[model samples]
Every structure is written in C-alpha cells, then in structure tokens.
Target: MDKRKKTSQMQERAMKTMPLGVNSNGRYWGKKVTPYFQRGKGAYVWDVDGNQYIDYRLAFGPVILGYAYDEVDEKVISAIRDGVTPGITSQLELEAAEKIVELCPATEKVRLVNGGSDATQHALRVARAYTGKEKIIKFEGGYHGSYDYVLFSTYAPPSTYGNSRSPITVPASSGIPSALGDLIITLPFNNLEILEATLKRCGNEVAAIITEPMLGNFGCADPLPGFMDGVRRLCDEYGIVWILDEVKTGFRIAKGGAQEKYGYQPDITTYAKALGNGYPVAAYGGKAKIMDIVGQGVTQGGTYAGNAVAAAAAKATLEIMSTQNVHGYIDAMGSRLQNGLRAIFKKAGIPCLLSSMPAIFSVSFGIESNLDAREWAKADASIYKKIAARAFEKGILIDEDPREPFCMSYSHTEKDIDDTLEIFDEIVRTL
Candidate 1:
C-alpha cells in the first residue's frame, strides 16, 4: 500500500480550518478520513500522495460520463471563455433545458437550479403551493438531499424508528428545528398497506408524497414490484401531488431516469447528479399546470443556476449520451463486475447479496433473509467496511460505508473491470 503522508498532511491542515476536515459529511469514514483526490481521468483517480486507484465511487454518483471527458470539457472551456455567468440568461440555458425536456418524459417545463438540494426544496414548495396543504409523506431510508424537510428518517438506527408497518419520523442531523418533524410523515418503503392506511387517514392534510424512485440511501435497493404503481395511484386518488426525487437515479439509470425505467409519471420531478456529469447543475420541473405556478406564486431562483459553463456542459453531456448510447457501455461494464464478484463470493463460501441495477451496485454481507432497512440493521456492516478498506489498500476504491453504492460510468473499460475483479477475488479470499 502507498503511504498517504501527503494526504495526511493536507488533512491535518484542513482540520484546523474546516469543520470535520471536509466540506461534506459523507467524506468522513467514522474516525478515519478519506484520501484527498488530486486528479481523475477515465475510471482512475490519483491521491495527493500519488497513489492511483480504480474508482467505483464515481464522485458519489455524479461522474456518469467519467472524469474530465474531453468533449464536455471542451464545450465548458469555450463557454467559460465567452462568459461564465451573465446578468441575464444565456442561449446555453435554453438549449440545456430543451435537452432535458426532450429526454425526460415528465418535464413539460423545467427550471435550472444549483444542486440536488436546491431542486428538492423547490419541488416541495411548488407542491405545497399547488395543493394548499401543509404536510408531506416521505419513505424511510430514502435520501432526497441535505435539506431539513427530507432529512427525517434517513440512515436512522432501527431502535429510533417505529415498527415495519408504521414508522416514526426521526431527524437524521442535528441543529434542525424540532417543529419540522411534525410536518413530515415517514413510512416504511416497499410496504403499500402501511402507506395506503396512513394516506387514508391524513390524505386531506398532506401536500405531497415525495420519494426517490429507488432507495439510493440504503445500498441501491430497487423498488418492489407494484410499489411505484401504488404510489402513483394513491396520489391521484387524493389531491396530493407526487414528487419523484431523481437526484441519484436521474440520467444514470436511463435516458429519462427511473420514471422511464418504471413507466410511472410524477407530477413533479427533481433532477441532478448525472444530469451535468460532474458539473454543478440541477433542475425541477413537471406538468406545465404545476410548474406554471413557479413564477406566479412560488419562487425558485439562484445566481449560479443556468450559468453558461454548467449549461454548456450539461447540453454536451446529454447530446453525447443520446447519440453514443453510453448506457450500453455502462451496462456491459457493470455486468462484468457484478458477475465476477458473485462468483468470487460463492467460491469463498461467503454469504453475500448483490443489490443493484446496471449502473449502481452494493454488497451486503451475511444477509440471508429478504429485508427492509430495519432488518438490515441486524447484519454486521463492519464486515463490509473491513473488506472495502482492504480493497482500497490493493489499488481499488469503494466506499468504506456500504450504504453508498459503487457507480459505474461509460468511461469504465473492460480492463478496469477485470483488474477490479482480480483484486476483489484476492481480498475476499482473505475474509
């Protein structure tokens, strides 16, 4: 293993100035700090200490096309040379929005935003304004963003929450106002009976039901069959708006995201992460009837929203994906990795379940029974974390915490998958 002297020095300096020595909480691995990345290209990243690794984290699921892709970088450079941000909207903004409208089925009208958190917060405001209701329903183990409204019940301990049929709303972070918990109703994911029962009692007071089409917070779990259909049906029955939070699943799962993959249309949809590849760009839009109220009664504006550089990057990224069929390449690489890992686990006689789609995957150790987030808590996650640390020492990078998934981009090649699988085999044998 390469010594991380330089990385440790940087962390020591940063800890004196920055809170937790990182900008985002996810960057920390318990008491241990993650390595600082100096540069990235294709499917590889180099640390400040000059150690190279085959990356599967993919910048927390944003580098869909890969790191520093030439085509997108060229477009962004040209846009930056002309101007980064103008007092008024540029032509690039219109072009980027048009691309999103064409690809995503639910977005009849779209508004550019700064990040995933910005899109989710605005979507909730629009929903509340449209239906004139005060409360919202969110599922347990689903992460929309860092905002206070949706932070309830994400990554919470099983003891803090209620039973499987019913769930109690618990704050995921500190310093959030306690009263905000009263406005949110948390329910178990993939359970339609509990959702229907709760909605029947509080349907009139609920403004909307916001959910990630897939549970990205807890290891890339797919939705149970008919769960999404039930959500759509119940929202229509009541007057509650349906907000599909596609922050993690958008643009990576399919051309139109989870909505296209599952054949369910939402009243409001939030887009981010893979939308701009690695750039800072996000959007929230849906049926024209709902978004029309954005400027009229609800306000969603940001200075960095629709900046020239990000707009050009997003436009180029979407065009390349459309013409080149990037999803096809991603699927091939993902399949190779998944199949190879499964074979390794079986040969080593380890109890493992690989939960994922073609773009994202996660490894669960010693889980035999089908489980929701509650039952999953009984499993020893430290086992997976130990394996992840061992893999990192062997020139491979996956999230130490198993909750975050391993994301494959179009840029990942067959060679990278082969090398990763070889390392994975060696690592699992040690366990």
Candidate 2:
C-alpha cells in the first residue's frame, strides 16, 4: 500500500511537464490519489508503484473494451506503421464515419475531433449557424464537456442551482467568464413542465437545446414518459435544434446510442469517450443541413482531428462493438453487476438505488433502488466516498469523486461483479 515511490515520481516528473500532473480531471481521479498509471490490461490497471486495482472508472465512461484491448492495440499499432498522420486521406477515417452513421441514425453526418469538448463546442457553432440564433439550452445535471458553453450548470449542486424550474447557470469551474452564463439557460431535468414553459418564454432566441438523453451527469435520470417527445415536438414547433449530447452515453447505452434506445432523434449528436476505446477521439454530426455549417465558415478543425492513431483506433473499436453479440454481451455483464449490487445492498438492509443502461451502472446511498434525479440530489456522498475508498483499498477502484456515478464496463466479468459485491457488502455492513 506504500504508493510513496510512484506518487513521488509523479510529483517530481509528471507535474513538471503537465498542469496539475494530468491533462484531465478524470486523470486526477480525486481524493488523495496521485495517478501515475503505468499499465492497464483487460479490467485491471497498475499505478506507477505497482499497486494494481480493478478499474471501474474506465477512463470516465470510455474504455468500453477495457484498457489496452488486444484487437484495438494491434489495429492502432498497425495504423501507426502505415504512417501516423498520412494527412491526405485514410480508409480508417472513412470507415469510422460510415460505421458511426450506420450505427446511430441520429448522426446522419459525422465529423471527427480529438476530444469531447471540441466536438460539443463545434456542434453548438453548427447549430447556431444553421438556426441563426444566440442562446443554448442545457439541463441542470448534464455534463457535455469542458467548453465555455457546455460548462454551465453541469452538476452545480442544488445550493446554487436554485429552484429546479429556474435553475442558475453556474459555471463548473473558475476562469470561465461570467458572460458565458448569459448564453446558456439552465433548466431542470426529468420534468417536462419547466422545459415547456422555458422554451415558450425564449424558444425564439434559442438556436439549439442540448441534453444528455439518458442523463449521465447525476447518476443517470431516465426521461419521463413523453418528456423527450414533448421536447422534440417543441423544437419542431419553434424551429429550435434539439441536440442529444451523447459524449458519455454514446456507445455505453446501446449500439445506436441513447437516441435509438429512447426512440427519438436529435438535430445534432456528439460522441466521445468510448468511441476510440480509450484513445482520445470524439465526433459531432446530425442533419446534413446543420453539419454543412462546419465546412462553410464555422471553423471546426483540429490538427489532431481524425489523426491516424485515433481514426484507426476508433474504426477498430466500432467494428468490435458493432458485432451482433457484443452489445448483448455488454448488456448482460452490466445487468449482472446492477442486479448483484442491488441484491447485495437489499440483503444488507442498506437502501440504495441502482441506475444503469446497457453498459454503465451507478450506485448512490440513501436513495431507493429505483432512482431519480431529485432523489439522487439527496444522496450521501460521504457514504459513497467511504465505500469507494474501501473498495479501492481492496483493489476494486471506483471513481473517488463524490459527483461521479459508478460506471461498469464491457470488459468486467461476472466474477468481477461478485467480488465487487462481496467487498461492497462488507463495507456497507460496517456503515
């Protein structure tokens, strides 16, 4: 358990080269842990000090096939040998795009990017151009990514969020200009009344309304019956573009993403995280009319966009996941964990809610097994944190941040879930 050497080396070397010792907050992974990932395979990873742990973070909703998947590694390495950035064109990019469009009907036209924030930012720009409007509408508990526009109202605790009907546009972090709030209007999620009223008030000024179709931010809130239909109808009525931000829910939920799972289509959709099987790549696309703005003058290009490595990785990732049985296998694995955890807590007399889709699952304390956003707002973070800490010490790693949901990946076997549940049961019994 002595992480001194690894943590020290990271502090001395890694921090000097990178800001805050990492590129993303997910890497920080929260709470007294200095992440110096040395290696990962299947469902396990080892820190620099050789401390091994089962990885439930799964790179924050990516790594669907687990870390360093054999097929993905071979594909990416093979592509590198062909040439890192052949620049002009590669069959890999075309293959990835075509597969994405075929899989997710909501994404009629796709454009590659290097990260989620960039994909989201450019999607907004395209929406703005196509609609000739100014404002963007986002939900209270949705997390799109780290862009000025999408940063507002992502898990801004109930204190600052105000009444759910008239939520405040609180930025996720400092350094964001206050003016960004003016461009974003925050709305309560899982409630159609407020969304309808808000759209009626300023639907004219709003160019696009973006949402996490499955609500990945606050432990996954299912859209109530007709909520999605109402939003889609209103968007059509007012000509407001509806965007489903699937950066987290993309490949995790189902093959066709949330749009398919929920039986609705968005004007625009953005994807990242699992798309490249842990490699850094993302994309945004939708109706051809809206995407056309990207080419005209909206400036949606990245030097690393569709680079050889990411493109090849994505192509291979999609092919593997797109298999007829892969989704079924993933759903089975996730369901096993979800049900096992629920049963474990139930038997332990611990009231807990299990929220999950096909490939992802989360646990919250002090909430019923049937979870909702409002109930999730009342969860005991300290309990989950204590549980996560205990699990980590037992070599089962979960997200240390109180805000993050416990995400399950496709690579985790039923045995992993059984062991996780055993440790969890022991931890909760002590609580």
Candidate 3:
C-alpha cells in the first residue's frame, strides 16, 4: 500500500463530483501531485495520508498567527455561542470596524465584507459613484478579485498584454463579458512615465486606479522607490480615486498595512486574508468623503458582511495585533528564513531574486531583478515548480506556482527556519 493511497483514493472520489477534484483551480496540481490536508496547527499541516509538513503557503496568507490559533478561535467560538448572523449588526461588528479605522491610516470608515473579492468590488463601486465615471485603470498583473470589472490582464503572458505604453486588456476568465474589458485600462506596473502619460490623456474619464502596493499575485514584486508616490500624485492631479488593494499585505506586512509601511495614503483601501486569521472576513474603507458615498445612491451590502463569527474573529485578531509584537517576531522569522534560502541558493550556484518584505516574499530563479510582472515572468518558474514539488515530497510545503509568495506566520520559529534551509540545501544540491 502506498503512503498516499488514501489521498489518491480521495482525489478519485472527489473528481466524480467536483471539477478537477478541487474547489479552487489553483488547488489542482494534477491527480498525482495534489494533496488533501486533514488538519493544521502552528506552522504545520498533516495530509490525509498522515504525512506531516512544515507549511509555508499558510493558506495563501490568511493564517498569519498560525492555523487554529487559540486566541482567535476562542473568540470565534464565543461569538458562535451568541449566534452567527442575527439579521442585523452586532457589537462585535462595530468593534471590528473600529479596530480597522484605528489601525489603518487611510481608513476613516469601513464596511465589512465576506471576503477579498467583496471588499475590492465594493471599493470600485464606491469609486465610480464618487467620481461619476465608469472607466477604471488596473495594472497588468494586479488581481483585485473575481469580479468581471477586475478579471482582466491577470495571470496572462506578458506578450499578449500588447505594448507597454498602451497595453491590451486580456480577460482572465471566459464568463466575464467583453464589454467589461473596455472599462478597464491595464498598464505595466512600476513604469511611472507610462502611467503619467496615460493619466494625462484620459485620467478624467477614469473613475479609479486600483492597484496592489506590491504585485502580491506576481511573485510579490515591490514597487520602485518613487512609483507609489508618483501614482498618488497623478491620481490627485487627475481627480481620480486611488484604491490600494491590500488583501494579501494587510495585516501580514504591518499593523497598518502597505499604506503605513509606504508612508502614502490612498483614497480607498481593501483588506482581507490576515484580518481574521483564516476566517472569512474583509473590509474596504478610506477617506470619509469617499466612504460616505456608500449610502448615497451607491449601494454596498451583504447578508453576511459583518456576521458575528467573522466580526469576532477580526476583533480578536486585531486586538492581538495591537497588544503584541506579532509583526516583530514574524519579521525576525522571515528574515532568518529568507537569508537561509538566499545562502542555500547561492551555495548551489543558482542566481535568484528574493522580492518583497520579510513576512511575505518570493523567490525567482535566474533573475537579478524583478521590477514588474513582465520581468518576473522571465524567471525560470519551471525550476521553482520542481523545487516546490520536491520540497513537498520531503515534508516541506510551499506554493508550486511561482507567482504566489511564501507566507510566514508568527508561529514559525528559528528551528523551523533552520530545518527548512537544511532541506532546501539538500534539494538544491541535487538540482
């Protein structure tokens, strides 16, 4: 009997009902490689086959404190005891919103949502309503959500995105209407000259410029020194709303997210992932002037937007973040792991670029610099995929896709980092 016999059998059974035997397309890595996790704890997970792994993916950056963190889970359970959603707002919801307003420098008012997609979708709608414009500008690799308006140019080859000066809008999904693409202007990130030119031409017609502070979905590429400031200035000059999408970088990067770390404020911001420590909770808010438009002819509401469970989870998570040195500890862990990996890759004679912050970063092989998604795409992703696959087999888990980043949790220790480096060195030696 194979060690993965149960996992393989479960996949076969799941394929009978679900598409590709997984709920999310990214979860499918083919029948042979895809794993089914039974449970998770601090910094680790166990597959259905009973194989243990040191998990670095962290469920795509949600389990910031660690999986099943007691502080957050206890709050959630207490809220559940009170009831989940009682058809109206609760005290827990208010506390969560208040915490967000207190921590996030740009967020004066907030509206909780079910997930990242909901937060980004409503942020765009508020921008349109506030500016009285229909068109929006998103970067080539920026992925706001699954919404039709934002599902353009993400995960597509750089060659298909047309010229850098005037890029093409390529739809990421089939069901999204073609007309929605017309409203979106996709531009190459980190190119301030092109952005300035585009804004000069038709910035008035554009309602909002939604962007991730860093290319979270594209190998965690950081913004150039002056690029973010340039965007803020351009948006202000053109009277266009600047929306910072911090779904991945929100709580993981810092207490106040990228806006705090970067020292520039946007008109609006979206947050999720680490807000609830793995619970489905999200929010979008910014200047009071912009968020106030929500009730005035601009609609944004959901039945489960600020439900008790989500609210309690967020409140607890934020409270812990405010009181403790969560970021400090995680930063140390991240720095250690990143330095170890860098040394290992160097010793193996592999040239790699490690991008973004210590908490959430990416490794791009055979590339010296990754300024934007196009440059990031030029890296040898096949090698990364192979490394990730091999790492999984050796009881280490990382995202196989090169675009996704390696997420670190507060639970990760120095021992974990040392062990990971040892395994990576062994794997790199073979390569």
Candidate 4:
C-alpha cells in the first residue's frame, strides 16, 4: 500500500547521521518524495522498494553511456584487481591523457583531477598564475564548481541580480568572504556586449573569462549565434585566458566536445562527467603554453589525481566512444524524445520552449526564450514540477527542478522515448 515506506524509513534513519538524510544538497528532495535507489542498469533504475523507473536524471549527467555499462565497468574492475590508487602515476594515466589530447581539440596537455569542481578550481588558479592577474569574470547561472570563487550568482534569487548593465555579484553561499566578490565580475549569459564592455573597463586586471559554452545549470540556455566566437575574440584581444568549463558538455555534445561542436577554441578547458562515464575523474588543460605553468612553481596535484581505477575507466570510456557510435545513438534517441515532447506540448496548447542540443536540453513552460538565467526564471515551472512528479509516479524519473536539463544517454531506446511521451501525454491532458 505504501510504496515509499522503505524509503521514508531509510530517510529517517539516515537523518540521524547525515544532514538532510543525504550526502549532496541536491539529493534532498524533501523527505516525502526523496528516492533511495538500489541499483541502476541501462536507462533504468530500481529503488530500494524495487520500483522501476526510466531514469532521465542520469546521475546529474555523468552516466553518459549508461548505468553499470559492461564495457566501462569491466575495465574498472580489471584495474581495481591490479590496484586502485598507489599514490603515484601509472601507464593507464598516460593512455587516458593521450586519448583526451587526441579527441578534445583545445587540449594540448591535461592534468587529471578528482571531479568537476577540482578541474574548475585548478583551471581558474592556472589562469591566474599564467596571466599574473588577480580578477576573473564569470557569467551568471554558469556553475563551474562548488568552490568559493565560482559560488556567486548561481541559484541566487533573480530579484537580487540587479540591473543587466551592472549586475550585482550575489554570492550563492553565505560562508564566502565578501572581499572575494570584489575580485569577481558576474554578467548575464548570451550578452556579449556587456562582456565586451566589462572587459574593456577592467580587462587588464582580469585573468580569465571562464564560462560554460551554454548555461548548463539554468535550463541549458544556449549561446546566441556568434556568442562563442565573440568570447574567443574578446579574450584574445584583452589577453584573458578563456577557460571553457565543459564539465557537462564534454564527451556528450560531440567527439571533441564544445570546442569541436562550436569551432571556438578556448585557452583552457575543464572536463568531467562523461569523461569517465560516471567514475570520479576530471581534467583541466589546454594550450601547452598556458598549461605548462602547472609544475614550474604553479602547484597542481591531488592525492587521488591519477588513480588506476579512474584512469582505466576514462580510457575504456573514451576508447568505446571513439570506436562506437555513442553520440549518434544518443542524439537520435534524444531528438526523438524532444520531437515527441514538442508535439505533446503543441497538442496541449501549452507554450513551451526547448533550449540547447538534443542530447542535453530543458523544457521551460510559458517562456519564449531563455538567453540568460534572469529570463529563464520567468518560466512557469510549477506546471513542469507537476508533470515531473506525476510522471515519476507512473515509472518515469526526472529532476523536479526545471532548471536542470533532461540528460540523454546512449542506452535510452526508442521504446523508452515512446513510453515516456505516452505517459507525458496522459499527464498533460489531466493538467
């Protein structure tokens, strides 16, 4: 009778030890609806109560191939058999780095890290070190990592965003020192004019202009035409290190990530997520001239940086991506799902805008365009929340927050797309 009975019990028990009964803040979807997953395989996951659902969250976009992919897992298992972390480098690390250099266009060299946050934090530091500057520029709603330097204007209330010309740098967290905000500048996404003006004013003091190719965190709001190229030109003109934070887009958008897809080269690029197909591996590197500063008095190292397990996972994942049609399959499936959803919304007479690529996109209701986080905040997400919650009840799983995009993987099938559409249609009609 009570499907979530076990889950509720687990939450109550977990809260005694862990804050909010979850390790990550995003995982706490309130005690009532938070799910405790048991295992995942392919495009589906089973909860502790043994309820099955077609998973679209994809562990926040890291499970690119699929959950428990045999090819990746087998490699990781074999590597673990040998050892995990020996606190030193191995041949596997070299192979993984080589594969990255071969595939990603912007990367001439790379330094492995533990996660997206590590990659981004180090990338910023490297930019500052290389340029001999103190200040950095980031776009509003562009989430780089959990570090203090980047924890501004992300998830902050739109009312606090101030004017578009001179936006307030609202800190995302409280513990961040107010003095840090002075060194950082936050601007709206998709607006190159503001970026150019800001850079012209303080370009010499700015070390890097770090941005996601698209707003990955706030409903995948895409760059306007020539936006990426404009950023490159301005960065070159101002002598600013362009750090493309592609933790979400890398290995998922294309074989060469955003650099290949958009044809705009960045001075430095940070990658995670699909790089290891859900394993804890990430990297930051770019032009040899910029990245070579890492060892020569510019410190960048980690205890588990090049662990064998993560390296093997990255090597296997990239090798499979190179040999197989991973992106092709994911694109096809994603397009099918996107088309089906568009048709459903059209038939329902509801205003909706889908932003970004087929593989990673967002469905925003009652919003014509999403150029930046401020515009995206105007979307009537309550309808989306209702649809997502009801769909979850009917064996579909998606993030309730509309800002988070729906991620597709190679494992999602045509049948899965059709089934999802059917369920969405049913729910939309009721709404």
Candidate 5:
C-alpha cells in the first residue's frame, strides 16, 4: 500500500483550522479518504506522499482538459498579471459569454457567476421573477447546489423520500428554513406521468422545473425517450420556466450540452464545472427577454462574479473546445473503460449494470437496471465501494461514493483505460 503518512499528518494539522480537514465537504464527503493531492497533470494526480494515481474522479468532474492545463492556465495567469477583478467589466467577460452563447443553443444571453450553486440560484430567481410564481419542482436526488431553495430531496435517505409519485420534500441539510421545503416540490425522475400530473395540478403555482438533463449526483442516468420532450411541452403549456442545471454535463457531454444531445431546449441553463477546466466560474442565462430582468428588475451580483482571470480561463477553454474534437477523444476513452470493466465483471461472473454517456458513467453492482435515483439507491453500493478501495490501494483512484460517476476527461488515454481495467480485473477476481 502507498504510504499516506504525510497526508495523514497534514490532515491532522488542517482539522485544527478547517472543518473535516478539507476546504470543501466534497473532498471528504462525510467519509475519510486519506491521501491528499499535491499536484495533477494529464490523467494523473500525485499525492503529498508522492504516490501517483490514475484519476477517475477528476476533481469531481471539473478537470475537463486536464489539471493545470497549459493553455487555460496561461490565459488565466496573463489576465491576473494584467489585474484581476477590475472595478469594471473587462473584454474577457464578453468574450467568455459570447463563446458560451455560441456553443449552448439554449443560452441566448449569459451572466457570469462564481460557482454552480450560485448559477442555479440565479436561474431559479430569474424564473420566479419572470413567472411571478413562488414554487419550484425538483427531482429527487437531482442536486443543483447547496442553497436552501434547491437543497431539498437531494441526497435524501430512503426513509425521508416517501414514495415515487409524490416524494416528501426532505431537507438535505439543516439550518435551511423549514418553510422553504413547502415552496419546493419533489418528484421522481424519469417518470413522465407523475411530472405531467404535478404540472397539471400545481403548474400555476410553480415558477420553474429545474433538473439535471442527465442525473449527475446520484448516477449517470439518462433521460428516458420522450422524457425531456414531455418536460418541454409541459413547461410551454403552463408558461413555466425550464431550468437545466448543466453544472456537471455542460461542455463535457458535448459542445452544446444535454439540450443538444436530448433535443430539448430549456428557458434557462446553468453552467459551471467544465467551463473553466477547474477554475471557479459559472453562468446562468437563457432567453433574452428573461435574462433582461437580471440587472433591471431582479438582482444578481457577486464581488467575484466576472473576474478577468476566470473569464480568461473560460474563454480559453471554450476556444480549445470549439477548435478540437475533445468529445470524440473522451467518448472513445470512456467507451473503452466502460467496455473493459463490463468484460472484467462478466469474466468474474458478477452481475452488474453500466450506465454512461461519453463523458460520465457509473456502475451498480448486482443490479442490471439502474434507471433512476431510487434504483441506484437500491444497488449493492458496498461492492463498488470495496472495489474503489481496492483500486485506490493499487494506485487507481475513483471516489468511494458510488453515487459519484467516473468522469472521463480529454486527458485520459487508452493506456489509462487499460491500466484501470487491469486493476478492476484484479479487484474483482478477489471478490
């Protein structure tokens, strides 16, 4: 096993000042994974103890091109040296917004923000302002962000999530006002009937229906055929705003994202994660008429919203994505990894289901149909967690939480896939 002694020491020291010894709850995820990363490049990360890992976590799906990618980093550095977060907006902000609008068909106008959570919050606020409504509908296990309004039913325990047709609006975090839960409605994902029924009954009260085009936080669950179309139809019929929270799927899935892949257009789209290739940047925008309210009637402001450095990084990342066939490489590599893992599991006589898009995927052990979040919750997660632990021991890195998908980047190669499969083969044989 790789020695994490130095990492452990740092963790001890960090916990004195920082909660859970990490800056973000995601790093620890209420569980312990000992090695701390010092640096990363291409498809690999080196821990503080100098052990290398083939990174499948990819900083929880943000490092699109790679960690510390030269072009993006150079642009960010240049912008910083020139002066970051200037008192006024810079050309970089417009350049970044233009690039995003050019690529994402759903975004006619765009406004920058600091992170995914903020982007989603802004999108919902705009929706409410536009529709003059108070309630919003979110799918169970579809995590938009940590904000109180969208935090309900995300990561809910099965006991709390009452039933499929009408799920209880269970709070994922405490200190969120109990009254906010009443404003938010929770529904089962991938079910058109319940969604249609809910809209028919409470469509007048709902300001928006926000969803991850493909379920990202629970499993990489794709929308069933016509599911997205149905959503669009219902939104149009009810004058309800549709908000696609593409924080995990944007740029990484395709140049145009899930709206392009699934053939449905949302009124508002929230983007982050892959946009700046690990830099903290986000945006929320949609129809020009709706986005007009952002500055005029509704307020959306942040001290670091359109900082030059992040805008430069996003512009550079988008430029690279526009010119190159990044998705082709990601798709090929992800397919290889998925197919290889399937073969390994088959050879080991273990029943498993693999769900994937080109860029993100998940495996549910002992379950052949991982159709929805509830289905994902029913899988033998302990087995995947064990495999993840074994893979970590063998220098392969994936998050132990099975809910997190394996995020493939443009940096991953055939060799990385092969090496990962070899590790999986070894791990499965022992099981």
Candidate 6:
C-alpha cells in the first residue's frame, strides 16, 4: 500500500451494507486505491484519500467540456431548479436535437435516449425493424453497449478468440447469454476482404452493420482507405442498415463525427458522451426513410429519453461545442499527449508507440506499432498493467485497461499534460 488510502469512518460504516464498499467496480481505482470521488474540476479528480490527479479518463468520456464547467453547471443547476425530470419535453430537447442534426449533416431525425448503451441498443432495434433482419455484423473489438447482441463481443480478440482472419466470438461478460454468440457475426478489424466475404455470405440475414467508424475499442485503429466505402457498398448491395456507433467518437472526433472526418455517411448514427457533457443523454437517427420505422410502432421510447435535465445539459453542451473549435482543441490535445508519451518511451529506451485519433489515444506497452484489433490484442497487456499501477502510485489516472484507449479532454491544460508526461517518462525509465 502507498499509505495514502485511509478510509474515512463514513466509508467504513457504509461498507457494511453496500456491496464492494462501492456501487461500481469500474469506479474503483485499484487494489490499493479506492476512487471515492470527492469532487472534480478542469481535468483533475480528487479521491476519498484526498489525492488529486490529472484525470486522463475524463469520467470515461462524458466530461468532454471538463468537470464542473461553470457554464454547464449553470445550465444543469437551472434545470435542477426548474425540476430535474419534468413530465413533459423541455425546449432544450428541441435545441439539442437540432444542434446534433446540424452538426451531423447525415442526421435528418434524432431520438434522445439515456446513455450510449440506450442509443446503440435502439439503433440496432431500428435497423432490424427497418430492414426486417435479425443479425448484425459487429467488429471483433468494437464495443457498443451492454445490450444482449452487443455484449457477446466487445474488445475480444486473442486469448479465447481464435483465427484472426475468421475470428471467433467471445463473451465480454458472463451474464450475456451464450446463444447471442450465434446471432452476431464478428468480423476482424480492418480486413476488408474478410469483412466483404462475411457480409456476402450472410448479408440477407443481417439487419445492420454496426461499427465504430474508426475501430475505437481496438486501440484507435484508423479505417483503411475505402474500407468503410466497401462496407457501405455491401450494406447497400444487401439492403442492410449501416449504423455508426459513434457513442465514443461522435462529437469528439469532429463536429460531424467520423462521417465528416472520413467523408462517408452511415444510414444511422448514435450519439452520447460528448452529447450531454456529464449528463445522461443519447440520440440515434438518420436518413428519415429508415427512421420512419420508429414511428410506425417499431418502438423506441424511454421514461427518461427526453427528460428535462438531460435535455438541458445536452443543449448546453452542443451550444458550447458548436460555438468554439472544440474539435481542434481535442485534436491538438490528443496529438500533444500522444507525442509526449512517445517521447517518454523513446527517452526511456522502450520501443513503444502511441496510436491516436485526435481525442482518443492508446499506448502499446509491447508492440512498437500495430494497425488493427488483432495486432493490438497481441501487444503486452501485462506491461500496461505495470505502468498503470505505477502511475496510480503517483497522482495520475489513466484508463486501467490497456486494451481501452485513453482520452484527451479540452480541460487538460499544458501544465497537466507536461506533468503527466514527466511522470510517464520517469515510470518508463524505471521499468
């Protein structure tokens, strides 16, 4: 133990009934670390132990405008004062959806949901209903959400997964019924030939081809030239819906998202994370032709879908993102952080490399470089564990899962970047 985590009497007292002494396992920092967030501000987080760290996780991408942003807080507070969950729709919902459609040119219609999972799950349902098919083609590592069909595969390659070319599917978590494995056709990342082949064989049964546009969960893998175009063609050739799971990369990648960045649009796109800052909100819809299915009782509704609080927060977030070059800031910050990490590896005599896409970045502990999910899975996850453990020893919070990409937020300043990089440099040298 680092001798810093002395549990408060309140914490000990609460643990008697609360499972794991906390609500979420993800929020728990480490064995020696229990991340009891006291407060957060401007790319930094404070734990129950009172240790402040420059937070690279960015509250798992929801804090895009940064923690406790004054403007956002004002909006949220205003909503809170008005009432967190109003019985009816707030004007903020209209404003937010309009902003999303405006930013995402492909979006002609939008339906708000609670979170990324809600957006993605509903997107799949809409696709299936629109196209009258049940199957979906999800990449080996691309994670959408906790829904059944999606849960069977999220960042699973190597280990239990066999044969990269025709990769086998594995369950991300236990509760996901094993039968879901059969419904999903898991494809290898960046392999257009195999992807095309798989779709050709089962395109008719497939309702939608859901992808992260840029295989985000697989170390921020950029799409190969014309790769997504090929995907679009296959979908069109078979009347399949091509839904972009931009829950992670949507607003963060660009104002129009990967579609704008890559110059190819999907039939539908899901939005969350950056959509609501830290509030609970998500949306999915595009090509009114397909979205029409949702209206005819194909179904998409939630008690909290357009709840007032989420609507207000999303509206405020969109307004801020639209008014400024938020994408530019994200791009620069990610580049700087990527370069800084690479410099540390070089100076430490470790042949490590960092891969990125503006806001999302990954540090490979073993491999010098890699192209896709299969390659990333082979990199040294154990080495990442070492680095993560050491970083936590100091006051830094990186995403603990090496397979998952770390992010850059607009809130992270030059000083925060410099200090974090310095710590990484020292840690790598010691390793």
Candidate 5 residue 239 C-alpha distance from true site, Å: 1.0
lDDT of each: 0.87, 0.80, 0.92, 0.93, 0.88, 0.80
Which residue pairs in model 2 clash with each other?
353-369
lDDT of 3 at 124: 90
In model 1, the Cα lDDT at residue 222 comes to 69
Cα deviation of 414, candidate 5, in Å: 1.3
Judging by TM-score, tell me the better candidate of 1 and 4.
4
- Tens-digit per-residue lDDT, 1-431, candidate 5: 63877887888888889999888787873333666889999999999989899998998898999988998999999999989888688899999999999999878999999999999999999999999998999888899998888888887775678878777889988789999888999998889899988888889999999989877988777788888888899999999999999999999889888877666689999999999999999998899999998877798999999898789989999999999999888999999998898899988888888886858988888777766778778788889888988899898989878888999989988988888888889889998
RMSD of each: 1.3, 2.1, 0.8, 0.7, 1.3, 2.0
Could you tell me the lDDT of residue 13 within candidate 5?
82
lDDT of 1 by residue, 322-373 (tens): 8997988898889899999989999999888888687987788778643367
lDDT value for candidate 6? 0.80
- Could you give candidate 6's per-residue lDDT for residues 298-386 as a string of tens digits? 87778888887788888888888889878798888778888888777877777676776758877786776566677777787888888
- Backbone clashes, each candidate: 0, 1, 0, 0, 0, 0
- Candidate 3 per-residue lDDT, tens place, 167-242, comes to 8899998899998887989999999999899988898899999999899999887889999989999998988999
TM-scores for all candidates: the values are: 0.98, 0.94, 0.99, 0.99, 0.98, 0.94
Over 4 Å off in model 6, which ranges?
A: 1-3, 7-18, 155-157
Instruction: Report lDDT (Cα) of residue 254, candidate 1.
Output: 90
Compare the candidates by lDDT and give the number of the best one: 4
Clashing residue pairs, candidate 4?
Answer: none
lDDT of 2 at 57: 82
Worst 10 residues of 6 by lDDT: 1-10
